[model samples]
Target: MHGARKAFACAVILATTALTSGQSFADEEVNVYSYRQPSLIQPLLDAFTAKTGIKTNVVFSDKGLGERIAAEGENSPADVMLTVDIGRLDTAKQLGIAEPIKSEVVAKDIPSQFRDVDGDWVGLTARARIIYASRERVDQTAITYEELADPKWKGRICTRSGQHDYTLGLIASMIVHHGEAETEKWLVGLRDNLARKPTGNDRAQVKSIYAGECDIALGNTYYMGQMETNDAEPEQKDWAASVRLIFPNAEDRGTHVNISGVILNKYAPNRDNAMKLIEFLTTPDAQEIYAETNFEYPLTPGVAIAERVKGWGELKPDDISLSEIAKYRKAASEMVDRVAFDDGPAS
Candidate 1:
């Protein structure tokens, strides 16, 4: 029976080798061109890899990814394009760089208002363009999008440049909420009250408030949570502790929330894998990871929010469809320039 035992061992070794070889062949690596910074997205990518064994390769760039993808055209190696705002996503769709993908998983997880009706792209997580008020300086009851333009807020408001995507999206939503004429007026008013030249990112705006440079600032809700929970630096923890997050326009249109979403590249080499990845991301499990890691709201209903997010209280998201905001981006940019906002330092 020694010869029989030897044969059985040989058979087991061959089976294991064949299994490993098959997995290596089916690995099917997907290339992702992401607008999000690495720190904000790598964790999610790692998780997906751990669960699916489908290796993910990513090129992270904060700017010009859309243009690069467009430049590559049908020859592009990118299988998916991930971006932060509706304006940028619309640009990709307008350029015909993204192809429509139909998946019941994506359709069910993402709200119709957060994606293209034709299924070209789907939103995964959402962030509100809300106000951060200094606990020691501002009255909570006086908070509103319109209030930011009030004379009282003059010399007390801090914000990043209107040219930034986050600010541009907020302006686009304003264009939708209050037509061009009124939006122009609000832009002028907000511009006139800037605490410093439109500089730095949302986190910088929050830091400025903590430094006593301003009493109120425009920023995303996630940044506040990031700062509070960040163990990497003491200053970030302090910045988060110094302010309170307020949902703007609660009574009227509700707070404007934007999303980070993905679309299949028009020239995807592995269309089936691309659809699977998109489907995986929109699932309740993946959506929860997004909310917990990125501090953004899940696009899928019934997904529980992270405890830190729940602490900020519930939000009444603006009912306006994201496409409406994307539609008015051109007008919003023109208004931004017409007011000479890019000319000199804001306020």
Candidate 2:
């Protein structure tokens, strides 16, 4: 009888040890697969951990991340997926990789237009698609999305490859405004005007203007603000000082805008924790951090713009639903390639 009791006690102890080890592993961390670069997202993750005692482990990659998540499917270890641009988010949704996130905090903080109509994802912040022109070489009043194609501006425009997501979205907005044929014509005309083969990111375009390589380019509003505020790169400040920002078509459709957003993975092990993180990100405090740190605008209504962002001035954004922008991505890509805009400068 004594020996049997001792054996039973050992069995109980082993079972308890296994259970405690499993719970410890589960409670200690949440996994995130992010398309946003690590530097841009680490602060938020750090803050979330400090507040919740839930540590975050992130895997950041710009490409193939969506595919990897989908491939993982029900086995995916990712609890949250954060990405910029509606196209990628929509792709994730269409691929059935994201589960609907039902949270009152998310629904209240983000606008209906910015969140998935079915609640699959929520936009956290917005970036405006705006025009940047060299103050010394171009007339600021001449700024307009259509003006980028003007013959007068030929040999004076510098932009990245049309194949890039930013340019694709910009051209997609044009398609929304003017239809496909007209957009193609505008793209061809814009192609003819390239000061150099489309090369570099938005910041590089500003650098081009500073070097007198070109006088005008299309860039995200945040990049402009970031450059202006960057004391680390005196040249970035000088480049920013030499350029002027123009929010296009304020009298018509208004300026085009895009978002950085988050979705709960379909197989998230910690759905409640994921919802909490998303809600936390949309709070006014987190929204302000997003704006100030990334040079983006808050998605939440009534949230005050950061001073540096406000200093860039107000904008009347196009009322077109961002979902509509996601819809046109493919056609926009085809139009870009058809015009050979990716072929560098025209002979």
Candidate 3:
């Protein structure tokens, strides 16, 4: 009950096996537990149902779908689980809420580097942790993660908490490259360069750069898309216009990336249908729908990224393996506390 939440739209609704409202139950259907907003995935689901005629039912929540399923135990109706962040996906595996998905099609569709080695989870799309540099103040056309620590940037950098998932993933990847000691030293330099105490989500960092509080900030690539297109918050568009994106380590190992992905529920009642859904999601067409809807990059090989995201320029994903990078997350979290990274620099 701690983090569990029942979806208000249809928490315990029975899966409508009824294909046609006027008719009885259809051939088959699947129940989906989704952390992603229903709007982002509904178009693809509608397309899938239109094609396959297999009815799909959704229980959407911003958080707690995983815990809710786990509490249901073996009787849970969830056929598939969809969420973002490999860390959360991996946690679901550790929690016994997920079952391995082994299929020749699934194996071939998702690159091994972006999925679980044992096939417990699979990445569906990608996002980069990129720098938001002031268009007017920053003169450099190129930059690297290593350079964020350089003394020249002192009092000029902004970031969310070093403890946030995005930053932790970046640091975990750094540990993979530089080992813990040197990475800790590098973190100290980055902390010293802080324009303010580490705070807020990625977009808030971009706003800091816009406000003249910092010359550069670290943020996710998709947030630029949200900011620019936001109608409710028009000021975010101005915030977006103030900075240019820089994919750190672009010339070398490439930028750090995180993913939005899926898992097969351990208690899936409609196993075959769930497998069908997962495979369908990885197809080039489905990947495009997912990518374009969220302004994210497609994970399936050769599928084009969203046109808006494309304008940021080509991204060569870092050479590190997400499975390997996930291994260092705990150490990276400890390192953040070890350095007091969110406390601002020493006075």
The most accurate candidate by lDDT is 3
lDDT of 3 by residue, 121-167 (tens): 99998899999999999988788999988999999999999888888
Clash count (model 2, backbone only): 0
Expressed as tens digits, the lDDT of each residue in 1-347 for candidate 1 is: 34422332343211111122345445566677788776677667766666666666677777887788787766666789889988888888888888987887788788899988767778889999988888888777436787777887788888887788888898999888889999889888888887767888999988898899999989998997889988878799888888888898787778999999998998886677777788889988789889989999998999988899888877889978888888888888888889976543353
Best of the two (2, 3) by lDDT: 3
Residue 302's lDDT in candidate 2: 83
Residue-by-residue lDDT tens digits, candidate 2, 177-245: 899999989999999998989999999999999999998888899898778878888789998998888
Write down the lDDT that model 2 would get.
0.80
What is the overall TM-score of model 1 with all chains considered together? 0.90
Give TM per candidate.
0.90, 0.89, 0.92
Instruction: Name the better of 1 and 2 by TM-score.
Output: 1
Stretches of candidate 1 exceeding 4 Å from the true structure = 1-25, 343-347
Q: Which stretches of candidate 2 lie over 4 Å from their true place?
A: 1-28
Residue range with the least summed lDDT across 10 consecutive positions in model 1: 11-20
